[model samples]
Target: MSGEEYRIGLIHATMNSVQPILDAFQVHAPQVTLVNFMDESLIYELNETGIVTRNMARRLLNLVEKAVMGGVEGVLLTCSSFTPVVAEISHLFEIPVLSADLSMLEKAIDMGNRIGVIATVEAAGPTTKTLLETISSNKQKDVIIQTVIIPKAFHALQNGNRSKHDELIHQKVQELNRDCDVILFAQFSMVRALETLDFTTVPILTSPEISVKSIIAEITKRRIVI
Candidate 1:
């Protein structure tokens, strides 16, 4: 917390949901602590169960407790899947707890015309899409949203083989560029792979950059004196 600014704890269910947000946040916050919850195994567990587990919920609380011990001012959960746990953790902590999806979904409602959400894991399909639709409906925005998946590329990242992951991302972007106006890199690990993706014409958005900005803006507007 050396920055003297408020610290926002980042809770990541997996590295796939951690890196990009942390990468973007480091530029904004020097005092942040990232709490990781899941391994690559959790992705498969999500696919198998069609819902998050009790252990997932427990780890989220553990991460927040650890963050508090480490002296975090607030917390941000990076996974769309484990937000149920995030909500519960928010009630325990005195400071703010944010879900990575909330702000961007707000933006999609406010400004996005045709939004493209791209996550690398196949299991992200139901949760991500459902969140988008729900947000759009709540905002009452005339938005068109399409969900995209790059499982092979994400799988490479999960295995810690970034070289292969970037390669797959390059090929995928070449095809996606034709369809999307803006691309949302939904996973945090995908941040490293951004420069590797070919987006000659379309602008790509990393969730960390946008989500962090939205959080900051809300803090400013509410003047939440952290």
Candidate 2:
């Protein structure tokens, strides 16, 4: 609420996540300033290994430390595959440190009993599933999680075939329609696929915009406390 613009540090594992989040901030919280730190190799390693090892989580923690030292009001990790690292390290920081999917997954649990998670990355599906289950358990809600992983769609996106990537995700969303009460795009990169399904009855959620709002709220709360 002050004239000073809030600065948020965005840590990314891939370039695909960068723009969608920037677009989200532009549309939802234009007054905030954003700084980005990207390590493309993180995504490559995760894709190759199909897991976030301790070394990878350590690298992400280092990035967040750097961002905090740079004086950001909050830190947002834009990759879904590494969301757990936020829970592990956020308490170490004075400012808000967030996982891109935390708010979206929590919201999904509140909105429905049957939640659908669609991800293009192999690591993202299980990461999201675990997060969804944890959030539901913490909230004391019973829910069913359906995760669909399409690695080929990520390959198509990497090859610059955006249309094919979106098409693949859209087809899977159609199949999950009858079974799910809400669907979530697990990665910021998957937000583009939302454009393809205009008539779906199931509620579809994406992380970037909602996550931006969550971080801003956290920043505001901290500011008030100070």
Candidate 3:
């Protein structure tokens, strides 16, 4: 077990999430091997319907199962919109299963009671807010959560205008910064906007780095040598 290179599965709903997690692994857990399972249709269908359908959940389950079959030691779901789906299926596997946003949110709750959630899509906002609320309740800490949804920026990025996407998100982050004690980017892809921001008084948390750290912590907690 000492020399083993653990393989972790990254399940994604969009290509936007892929690079952020890869970057995180490079910075934090370079020893582990990453396997990505992507289904762009999942995000497209969710946006079209403005809901997570039963079929989407099934597809996510299939992806997770496929990753397990492929010999992954852990599973990380990179889309914040599907975090709740991870909850339902994680118990089915013996390996560590995680939602990318969970560790970030937990850290956000610990950092401040006034948490601002920023998302580039309508689907991610409510899900992130819900997760923050749950974490706050379980911790018995009251929190005020505000969510800003910027779907136009998502469209801009989709159309290959990265500058426009970063501008829109940076502007909203500035506005949120004025009031929030801590801000959390609700999606892994949204973390890119931080590159454009010059400075902020409040702390901003992103999922990928925090998620990778949590994955390593989980592996250690289970006493797995890697």
Candidate 4:
């Protein structure tokens, strides 16, 4: 990248994950400009279907297309539930397309074979576990993944009770710490809960910071500057 500012587009499935990613960008890659496209309905729809429908895939593609047309150097899909779809069509775009959880998952796998995934949303737990398994398979590593979902935590977050949300997630993390080599927060929104708690048992991985760093690396690698 020359002297121009790099622009990155973020595709979010919910409003809950936006602020944490933005805050992470501000701290880690302050020079990069961020453009966010949020479709809160996508998460609800995916939760109901338990799979990515054709229409939902099309909507995600359209969002990426819009970001490319708007001159973004890279696109980050901040929804773990749609990672499979994003991975499928990522090659179609010339710009780098990254899943929010992949970077964190890689780190978790590298750290240990027994991984613990904690999610507030039911869909996120399975989706993230599958992604981790797939990635580990490709790397020729056999890993054991344990997933825990706290539906009420998500409900509390949606209702604006961040304290309750954090408390619930923190409790789960403490329980998983004894059994897991590393803990992965399955959703970007859940990463915020880490800020208020102190856990010394295992390394807790979150998506936003790791994903931001990955996107910045891609932008720098391609020398793409806005």
Against the hidden reference, what TM-scores do the models get? 0.79, 0.96, 0.95, 0.94
The candidate that wins on TM-score is: 2
Which is superior by lDDT, 1 or 4?
Answer: 4
Local accuracy of candidate 2 as per-residue lDDT tens digits, 1-46: 2334799999999999999999999888888899898888999999
* Residue lDDT tens for model 1, 56-98: 6676677778766776655677776665566566777666667
Model 2 TM-score, all chains together: 0.96
Per-model tally of clashing residue pairs = 2, 0, 0, 1
lDDT of 4 by residue, 63-145 (tens): 99999999998999998888888778899998899988888898898999999999988788998998888889999999999
Q: Between which residue pairs do clashes occur in model 2?
A: none
Question: lDDT: which candidate is best?
Answer: 2
lDDT for model 3, please.
Answer: 0.89
Local distance difference test, each candidate:
0.66, 0.92, 0.89, 0.88
Where model 3 places Cα greater than 4 Å from the true spot, the runs are 1-4
Query: What does the lDDT read for residue 180 in candidate 2?
Result: 97
**For candidate 4, what's the RMSD?**
2.2
Give the range where candidate 4 is weakest over 10 consecutive residues by summed lDDT. Answer: 1-10
